[model samples]
Target: MSAEATPLSIHLADDAATALFGEDLLLALQIGDCVALYGDLGAGKSTLSRALIRALAGDPDLEVPSPTFTLVQSYDLKIPIAHFDLYRLSDESELDELGLEEALAEGICLIEWPSKAGRALPKNRIEIHLAFAPDGGRTLTIQAPEGRLSRLRRVIEIRRFLDGHGHKEAHRQHLTGDASNRAYEHVYPVDGSARLVLMDAPKRPNGPPIRDGKPYSQLVHLAEDVRPFVAIGQALRERGFAAPNVLAQDLDAGLLLLEDLGEDGVLDSEGRPIAERYRASAACLAAIHDKPFDREIVLPGGHRHRIPDFDRAAMKFEGELLLDWHLPWKRDGQLATVEERTRYLAIWDKLIDEISDADTSIVMRDFHSPNIIWREDRDGYDRVGLIDFQDAMIGPAAYDLVSLVQDARVTIERPLMDQLMADYLSLRAMGPDFDESRFLKSWAIMSAQRACKLNGLWVRLKDRDGKPGYMRHLPRTLWHLTVAFEHPVLAPLRNWCIEAGIELPESPA
Candidate 1:
């Protein structure tokens, strides 16, 4: 742990000692600001008021007297302000007589014992509570509107700067023994260095991510081919996508230290639905394809192909795994006929051709539900983040869209899909080449390819790893395949899968 990584705690002791605490709280004051100070007598309420007035006036001597029986003490400061001690006021009339509202309209006003003023004070005000600590110190609690959280963050930054340094071991103590096994373990301090969060991998580390009997899941070791993943994230961020910034990476060790976006993603706490987070995600996709990605940037992920073409052989080979492993081995006691397997391969070939020559942009190869993180703020693409982006490539523009709208993990409401697509089209004048008639055909073909690919992945995860829970997604995957195969343009392929006994699972299960 380094001193820079230490947590922050907002501590204040006495009114006369406010200068030693720092300028963070004082600098946060502004025009039309009403601050309600809460504390018992000798709790440093007047002390804080004096520090605030001196701060605003650029007074080095801190020449400010107690208002006590005088009620209000006016100050000719850099911002034309007034400091009032309303602790002695017995009635609301005394507050009105102080001209608080008038002063607020023209300049900054700092009010002590503001509760006595009641409705006379503005609702949009800062509230500060001071309490004596166990060791004769003071703790201050500041509250403001949600919009001010950013400004407050800035104040926090300054406070940290003034504190010199903090206890180093406190940060290192947070790391668990299992931390190295996960990707992205970040330590960030909060609450003025009083607490810290050790963010692990964004997604749960299900089990050891070993491959081929070797522990290959560590993100620090990067194959040369995988290096492009970092560049793609940088590019997407430049274009405005909620992609995670790489905090640190040890490519040789396959370890990646990354920023933690907290526990916010498309899914809600109840695990029921992924609504209220689709709009921004849709916008990000729209933005990616809004302007043709700079042709100069080299696309990454696969070596055999780039953004414009599909690896038909790879798709065909992957599609066969679905039947070879997932479907009942003996579909009611006999192997699938050679004719059936060949026909499905032909379907894949045709669909690949349909999108092979289409317009291309960056396609986050698996832009499905799990890869997206939801936020209702500006952090996400609008509040939705794009994760699992290492496999991104330049491919058909429809690839990512179909992946998002027709996700196999979760079914999206049809109306929502309609609105998202309409929103996308309004932003992008797609092109004469991408008319509705052509788009539907291309969408069906792409959806078919995606569905077939997912079904194969389920089989691989299950038979190869004994992970059977993934079987649940099979039915939904089949439905998407069915939708694609049944499209008017894909009717021939649809009938062939049925005749070949593909045996797609029953959905709505």
Candidate 2:
């Protein structure tokens, strides 16, 4: 171990504390981690291991038998786990027969009595030493490599946050995480009556400057901290929308305890879009756009979050993702030539100019299915719960409509998408000064722009981030792009894509 590796000590007052520690540790663990437990007989090693395994299984009452006699116990879970008791091993080489290497390769391995394995143990494993405390409790000292220690410390910080907020005994279950660094958990109270969501979004550091001494996120106006979410969510809730109420927050820490909006989304159990829910969501967007909104929102503690404009530069930067990532990935690392890229940017420049005078509103940048929730028990617009709107911008209202009807993640059939567009237009038309002709043109431009961004974003996620699962949405996004090109405003871009050998479905008659 490196000399810089420091030991973190904790007091476990009882079994509950140990179990909570196990759950906290689960948040920090990833695949290929090895945790070596050192403790004397009946020193609470078994308790901690069992709690961790049960938490990983997401079943608190799961039966986790001791592996003392069997030597090893393996579980196939969300992330597979292998529990090993090295006490019975006669030689260090016996680890080979026990599949230690294979276990470490696939998932986490928790080893008890690791001293028996001697030098065969992993060099970078986390070491946890449990001992009896003078006050009749257990004291645990943990030492881990720097990378793991950082994550562990973050998890502990979150635990302390919860403890301060009167949820010291709440159960934390991993809910969902997105492509960004933000993660969420369902916090169930001890009484199990109601659940809340814990948003763990640490303030992101600025990346290497991609353009004009600013990172891509800054150029595109992405939220770097939780302030925008708090401000926007409060604004939405005050407008009587179903944005979750912020219960507690640590602004600097980027943590928020939010009202749980329930699990019912706009998709059916089979993941197909429900037309009624989609229509409701469209109507909700129309309602949001109809009202005149304030650009500068005052947050709690007298802080202000001024929404940024989705300007021409931001749109161009996003559209260039297609050239930067998608084309290279599709063409086997062949980048777009300077001439081709110039032509592409010229086309987008004209399109953005055309939409410059279009109707503007607070654009929830990602108003798609994944970010929407369905609240059937509510009525009208309240039935559509809005989540994940931290990246709000003052932009063309039609951009959000395109995001909805041409959802990148799911296939919105032509008929349904048309119906949704019509419904949204009719609703907007009811308001004063609505221009369908101008709105349609802006919608077409934004649709193509968003499709370009997503097409490259999916590839970038796969190649750069090692998240290949996002590639599954490539065909859907491509199809959406083809649909967008069906608009007369996008004809030039369509021709450019064709000349560049970008495969797009034929525009329908």
Candidate 3:
């Protein structure tokens, strides 16, 4: 990390604004973070720290007495934090005596008057300086190390960006994110109306080339920035689809201010899949796929983002994730031998092009339940709102249709899947060139390929990334793959599964 990285600065309008700033800071705080707060007496350092601690504890009314006398106030919250008052310390050595060093290693530490501790502060700590304003507000200057606090820096940058764009006093509330590194916040304006979603999708480096000297992301045409999102989103909205309106954007920085699609989705209160919503979502896919699209889309500022084709190599890479990640994890480190590996690749090599699209229509890779927001108040297809479609590609329309009916996250009952597929096909029948048999075959092939990818991806998320939340979906993935095999197009995949000793879960009777 370079010391030359720019520092972040933010201005506060009042005490409430300072508290809001503190909440924003806490969004980036993790265990082992040391926030060195520097400010003069009554400069609202403690006030900001108090708000941060309270937000972490999830108690707005939690009493946070100053630790001036105690020197340290420890909270037994979700992530244990230590609040330290270094004002009365005699020298830097007192930090050790007060166990501040140990607390820094154990949990997050917020230190007021960090200058009193002098050089004892951690080198990678986030440094914040506050100053009094004549209007009784505060000015906060924040400096975070480049790599460690990159997300923190991006959060503040996005906040300031929004502030400059008519959301200066918008209140931010955290929204649960997916397994990806992206984070979202619901931004409510000061007037308490018109909420927006702030997407803090910082640009990430492409990993080392995994196959054929190309990174997996590049190979699969994964979205590396917000441009694909903006382009694909505008294309969808322009076609009268329910893709969110991009209120504002910072494409290079991977930040976006998007319209809040509200909390309603294609799921019930108990979180089961809603049949009506799923049918409508399937119809939405029909509407999108039936249209003609171009590989290259022109975006705002005269910039062009070309949608990549889901070609032969991309399909092969996805299919191999089952062998590369999931199979090894499932076998407890026992990997496929050279023969099994050859057979797996050979099968995909033969069938890849059969399922692969030839730059047909946009296939939003993740058109599943979780990404579909069901706005009941909207008219017609608008009720099925789309989110998380940044990784759009020019693929077979059947791909997104398979994604909708046979979702990885939710169990679409066989009847529901059948009904949704029927609903979808009926809509496509309205078009002139709809080839029913080929499209159904595409559905089968795409469904099988998707199941294989999900199986491997969920396992990779758990075994490689140390996230076990995806384990619960493994059975469903296998079951979906088994269902796909009922179609003759996936016979090769079924045979390979048998040869590799990959047990397909039995279909529900």
Alpha-carbon TM-score of each model against the true structure: 0.55, 0.97, 0.86
Model 2 clash pairs are none
TM-score result, candidate 3 = 0.86
What does candidate 2's lDDT look like per residue over 407-509, in tens digits?
Answer: 7777888899999999999999998999999998899889899989999998999999999998888888888789887789899999999888888964321
- Candidate 1 similarity to native, TM-score: 0.55
Residue-level lDDT for 121 in candidate 2: 84
Which regions of candidate 2 are displaced past 4 Å? Answer: 2-4, 506-509
Tens digit per residue, CA lDDT, model 3, 438-491: 888878888888988988999888877888999888888889899999998778
lDDT leaderboard ranking: 2, 3, 1
Ranking by TM-score: 2, 3, 1
RMSD of each: 17.7, 1.7, 3.7
How much does candidate 2 score in TM-score? 0.97
After TM-score superposition, the amount by which residue 4's alpha carbon in candidate 1 deviates from its true location, in angstroms, is 40
Tell me how far the alpha carbon of residue 232 in candidate 1 is from the true structure, in angstroms, after superposition.
Answer: 1.1
Best by lDDT: 2
